[model samples]
Target: MPLDRRQFFQASAALGASFALPAPLLAAEKGKERRIDLVSSAFTVALDPSGASRSAVWGFNEQLPGPTLRFRRGERVHLAVKNELPQETAVHWHGLRVPNAMDGVPGVTQHPIATGGRFDYRFELRDSGTFWYHPHQASFEQVPRGLYGALIVEEEKPPSVDRDEVWVLSDMKLDNQRQPVEDFGRILDIANDGRIGNQILVNGLVAGSQRTLTIRSGERLRLRLINAASARFFRLAIDGHEARIIAFDGQGVTPHPLPAGGLALGPGMRVDLIIDCMGSPGQSFPLRDLGRPPATPTVLGALTYSSQPALRSKPLASAVTLAPNRIAEPDLAKASDHYIIFQGGMRGSPVIGLVDGKPSRIQEIMAKQGLAWTMNYNAQHEHALMHEPLLHLRTGEHVMLHMINETDFLHPMHLHGHFFRVLAVDGKPTPHREWRDTVIMGPRQSIDVAFVADNPGEWMYHCHILDHAAGGMMGTIVVE
Candidate 1:
């Protein structure tokens, strides 16, 4: 069946009478710090229409995609994470520029919280935009096993709209019994396109017309899209509607229309869209991901209008721009330039690299070390307790990172603790030159990004593809 047309993909009632997403974990009060108790453990849930099938998942507060933690900008938050899983884990606040100790890369920032242990993450929210949290220890396995959540910090006076929604988009490789397939971090998968998921999810439910966004005609919505998948890039389009992008990776940007083809959202990224629903009452439009093959999109969900009369005859005539965060702009004239050459992959050029600091071929590194990727010709494996960061800069230095991708695979590169201006891709200046904590690097492409090293710490810089991270495409950056 062709999903692009979506004639058979109406938002069904099979999921439930009202398939509502889990509400925000808790709200905040003015002049007061918000605190929450988050527990990570394995639980069972029915993932399909059949009540007989249940999936064992690891989630926070017992909710897959965890709880939506919403807070006001500048509010202090105390999140106490208790790990009930057998293995150790730590929570990383994705895209948040917090103090280094709270960044949450187990070996880099803090020690992994052992089983039956609790770690208190106390930080003050300095910026407001779409962000997320997930386990940093063995993330290649933990994230895909249902351990991630949205963390939203609202601006003091955000644009007025009918409603706000958060969608955590992810995918899982499920087995016959609807359980997660356990194959993780295989060299073959790590060196290729990473381990692609078999089942797509929106807000923890199997997507494809099961979930819906209900709206009244002429209503406006602020949709926050988070890609929590281990490795899935979404090229999305809204049928019969216009959605202007207001933010990327939690940083405000000039409202822009859909790119020439579609909006490409890679793993570990977020997009804030301002969608004015001008559809007629009782009509529905499909939100599709065209990245998958066969010229057919996978229906992520639909925007359905209710039977009530239209809220207005025309779309709201108001600005939908977001206020910018206080990120220090890079002084390019004084910024120091650095290079990071990425090499090795299943289909990449044959190159000689290091294994345990000894010279070796890429093939030998994969066959003997269970690793398949390299950053800067160094064999700094992810399983190590300590390592030399790929780049080091003095605190408060402005630096430009020129990342070269020598492999034949798309890598969504994610940098923790700081947002960089994407100056260019493939040697061409970006129109917006948007600030992002994560950006996609095309095969054999070059990207230039610049950021101010204002936050001092050892930050994890790695591929958002979890398997690739496990297979040694991961490293750390230090500023001191």
Candidate 2:
């Protein structure tokens, strides 16, 4: 269904609330012990190490990027979300298999959790891996303003590592006063990157050294990297260590053992990695970025080293065992190609953002009750007409996408409903091939991602920049 404007607002009004139950009680185990409470409210906090001024916005229980809710596979998980915001908010469980009503999508899967009201979300933990939760109402505004958290469903067994850390990355816009900047009207500029923020924060703090963990020279570390940003796409790297990507978007994959590459992460995307420390004892290994200029690359966190011990260590058990059900890959002749050009902004200055070829406006959005802003040139959200014919395939046919980034800025193109393989980047197959949900495309660069459209729905493909997406940089597909 297209985005329903009035319905969204109506749902928001109905679900807004304040206050939360106790945390320990929320997570207290019953029978076998399994429950959690995730708090949602506005906050005044800092993301950079300089510790900037506090701001106002929605957060989980007054905390930015709320609590990390962990559970074991096959267990019954209960979550009580207490909304403390002045406006309505609901938590959407991204990439989880549960009853539709527990999905936390306001006006869609379930009703919003009204202000001063509470909702009990109970579901069977059918799958285990990295997942996240965030508001779905006014998604452009709510999510960007800091309403997200990590939801890790641990497997009966887990991956081997000396330590496991969950990292959530986000961006923010603040005034000279260091307060969160709020201008709902300006956030919908079809002529510019919608909601592009000036400040970057990791785990709810700005780029600054916070905690230091001790690691040995040969110790294996696991990093669960999650992109919960409302708009920004991040390219992440760590200095002085070799890391291997073992999972994505919450599911384990065929382990492709390779050196760590720059992670192109988008909103709602997750990458699980195993790293072997090569630095000497007492040295610090910083998780740095080889990010391009204008997009600063800095240390998200650091790992301090301890003297190596003589005793051999045992690896943590694998989180998952069964292989994922993968669809066949498409060959060149058996696949189809499509072209999407992000057209907007003045030619020389690449700051202007556009979907397909048109600019979006609120008046335009309000005019269509069921229409949403499409990111590509297509007008109908997810139903844009292509310059070429739609790619047709059998029920289980393999499909390849040749996605080109025509603009100067970066775009983390995400495909909902299915994971695809990075077949080629700029005309070559990915060196160490792996399945990915979001592929980052820099200006003038192109990438080929293939997947079998097995699980059918109105899948979306667009830039992960929430601002760009809200301004009309999105489209959808339907499989019959």
The TM-scores, one per candidate, come to 0.95, 0.73
Choose the strongest candidate by TM-score.
1
**lDDT by residue for model 1 (312-378), tens:** 8888888888889899999999999999999888886797778877889988998888888888997
User: In model 2, what lDDT does residue 130 have?
Assistant: 81
Q: In lDDT terms, how accurate is model 1? A: 0.86
RMSD of 2: 8.3
Best by lDDT: 1
Which 10-residue window of candidate 2 scores lowest in summed lDDT?
16-25
Residue-level lDDT tens digits of model 2 in 8-36:
33443333221111121134567764766
